[model samples]
Target: MFPPLCCDSGVDQASRRRHHQSRKMAMLSFWRDGLERQLAAVTAAMDTLQRQIDRDAQSDS
Candidate 1:
């Protein structure tokens, strides 16, 4: 009975570790996706501003 209990404990610990790892991976993916989206938005805004600046300079010339 004692040996069986030890084996069971090991199995439970392994399963818990896997669960924690999966959760960490999920959170990392979520943050990464959010960062990518924000970066894309910033880049698009920059492009628009740059284009406007160019247009303004050309008009002045």
Candidate 2:
């Protein structure tokens, strides 16, 4: 689901751990960005609904 992580040419365990951590961090970042975007969209929608309700109530006066 993501581009490959940058990895060292060495085959030692530390290099492998670095590569794993890099990939994990990348995935987390991606997920966080997506969640934040969705939250913003929901918040905007709620604000719009509230405005419409308020406007309608005022018009009834």
Candidate 3:
């Protein structure tokens, strides 16, 4: 088992748990934002490629 970080009373443990949860939520939010931006960029690039393909198909016809 992992060693205890500190000698935590009930109130101290509750406070520490809340602090950890808040930090974890903030980190998740940061990752979600980065992923959203990446997805948007990928979608835009795909759209551009699709347009180019359509243009080439029309020219070939």
**RMSD to truth, every model:** 7.7, 3.8, 3.3
lDDT string for model 1 (1-61, tens) is 0122234454677786676688889999999999999999999999999999999999999
Report clash pairs, candidate 1. Answer: none
Off by over 4 Å in 2: 1-10
Write the residue-wise lDDT of candidate 2 on 1-61 in tens digits.
4434754466777777687788899999999999999999999999999999999999999
Model 1: worst 10 consecutive residues (lDDT sum) = 1-10
State the weakest 10-residue window (summed lDDT) of model 3: 1-10
Instruction: Tell me the whole-model lDDT of each prediction, alpha carbons only.
Output: 0.81, 0.86, 0.85
Off by over 4 Å in 1: 1-11
Residues 1-61 of candidate 3: C-alpha lDDT, one tens digit per residue: 2335775676576777777788889999999999999999999999999999999999999
Clashes per model (N, Cα, C within 3 A): 0, 0, 0
Model 2 misses residue 4 by how many Å?
Answer: 12
Quote the lDDT for 3 in model 2: 38
